[model samples]
Target: MKVLKFLSVLVVFAIIGFSYWIYSSLNAPHAHSKTNQYIQIPQGSSTGQILVKLAAEGILSSPLPLKVYLKITGSGNEMQAGEYLFDSPITPLEVLGELNNGRLRTVKLTIPEGFTRFDIAKRIAKQFPQNPPEGENAVLNLMEDISLIKDIAPEAKNLEGYMYPNTYDFQRTVTTRAILEKMVGEFKKIWKPEYADRALQLKMTPHKIITIASLIETESRLDEERAIVASVIYNRLSKGMPLGIDQTAVYIAKMENRWDGIIHKSDLESNSPYNTRKIVGLPPGPISSISESSIKAALYPATTNYIYYVLNVEKNDKSHRFYSTAAEFERGKAAYQAWLKKERR
Candidate 1:
């Protein structure tokens, strides 16, 4: 009878222990059940603010348990400031560890090849608005800062073609000038001293090379075709023929925000020095942001005798078919026009 009573008592204790274990498991400070998310702890945010943000993002179920956990673990004094990416279902304990350790995810910004200064300014404004307003005058003034544009083009008024197009990683608090400086610094790092000598050998200045590169950047999206486009520019320069590129006119029109869909006759007739159609040689400045491939093409053109190129209508992949005669170019243009009409329909 005593053994039976003792067994009954043990059974009662076992049930109580199991229930306590289940309750503790459910109410544990580290129990998390959500997925991937990014939490940005803004600069100068207090610990309470950060905790509230985390709770709001569903990283924590309640601030009470987190505060208790933080107090118990002595992590309240160790929260670092930065952007952090958290995996779903992460416990408050894990998040506390992340905050204390200051693990931050890098934000990527891609600057595409052939982006103009205006496009670049818009991009910068989107990424870092703490520096200046995105107005054209402000952007232009920022671009003209000699400390940024001097290495690539000292004589140029703006850092038009010098802002090297590439992917960059930056923190949230990074300023606009810092971003531009990094891009221009990359350009300077890549601009070899031999390139300047080579430019002189080609009887062109570095500014002129950048200008031609910008034209090539705007002319073709296909990296393989940049050299061909560069050859067209070279051929025009060699023959003293005007480089009749329409993108230059569009660029001018865009500066005044007057660019409609179609390029009017007056657009081609605009008196800007960037009007390659009216100019006898290279544009007065770069027409767009030049990529490394375009720069290479400008420095070393293809050995083809072709002097003209028209967009390939069938593929429409920004690739062009080059020609040595205006008649062949005219035929290509006719094909392109027909393709354009069909596309419109």
Candidate 2:
């Protein structure tokens, strides 16, 4: 009977000791001094890898105890992959909790309005460096997956302008293709049912509407000006006149992979359907990402007789001076050229 009592007491003491050890380890501060620097945890990393990483970073004095605790709590398989930051020394339990909850480190990526897919590809390439990081061209090639919008844009050569412009929180683990998919998904959500009906009224397909929206987006930054710009495009199209948007020249230059910042005379002279200055109607596809305002402008254009517009140089706000006659447009063009020369000098 005495032996049995002693054994029970011994077991109780052992349990108390184990509990104290765990509590101490969990509440103890780590050795990390670099508060600003984040620890990048790659995807598919195991608990063993995590522990080793923590020990190497001086985040843990002993990895064995944490590993044991994680296994005991069934959290060994729950460590999420992401960039993690420990602002101050934290307990192993806290770190484990963070990992289990999956507070992934993310970067705020804003794809600004009027950005082309080429521009987006550059930004994606810069953000994500794979084992060796993909180049700009590689990223561009990934964007060639046009199946995302096939039903909407049956004639889309590639995902040139369908990647919607918006701010995104991208996880480090997210692939370049994943980002492109998300952007296009965002575009799909914004495309309302009424937009199709409106397109029907305008005798335009959804793809053509997107094409017009891209033109409006590239033509001017002003929300108020988008409708007027859309009207000018419509009026020109009705009259069998060239769209004359210089941004289309930039798009063609990018397509031919010869864009060098300056719009070369050869670029303007190129006879591609994308070169709207030479093409008599809408481009074969969108030139840049379309925003909601630009889309709305394309669908609900204001009625106007104005067939020409030039930058309002005196205002310098990217505002335009609209004209219905060729002579009026010529006067604006000369003034714009003079201002351009003065600025260049």
How much is the lDDT of residue 19 in candidate 2? 79
Query: How well is each residue in 67-127 modelled by candidate 2, as lDDT tens digits?
Result: 7776678758878877777757787877777777777778777899888888888888787
Task: Looking at model 2, report the run of 10 residues with the lowest lDDT sum.
Answer: 125-134
**TM-score of decoy 2:** 0.85
The TM-scores, one per candidate, come to 0.80, 0.85
| RMSD after Cα superposition, model 2 | 3.7
**Candidate 2, superposed: residue stretches over 4 Å from native:** 1-25, 33-49, 64-82, 131-133
How far out, in Å, is residue 47 in model 1? 6.1
Cα lDDT for residue 227, candidate 1: 89
How badly does each model clash, as a count of residue pairs?
3, 1
> What ranges in model 1 sit over 4 Å off?
1-77, 84-89, 134-137, 314-317
Per-residue lDDT of candidate 1, residues 1-345 (tens digit): 999999999999998886675445335554344455467887788778888988887777766656755655676878998778776656666777888898766668789887888788877776666655555567667887766666556788778888888899987667677778898888887778888888999988899998998898888888988888899889888999989999999899988878776899999999898888888987778978777888889899988888888888778677889999999989998998898889899
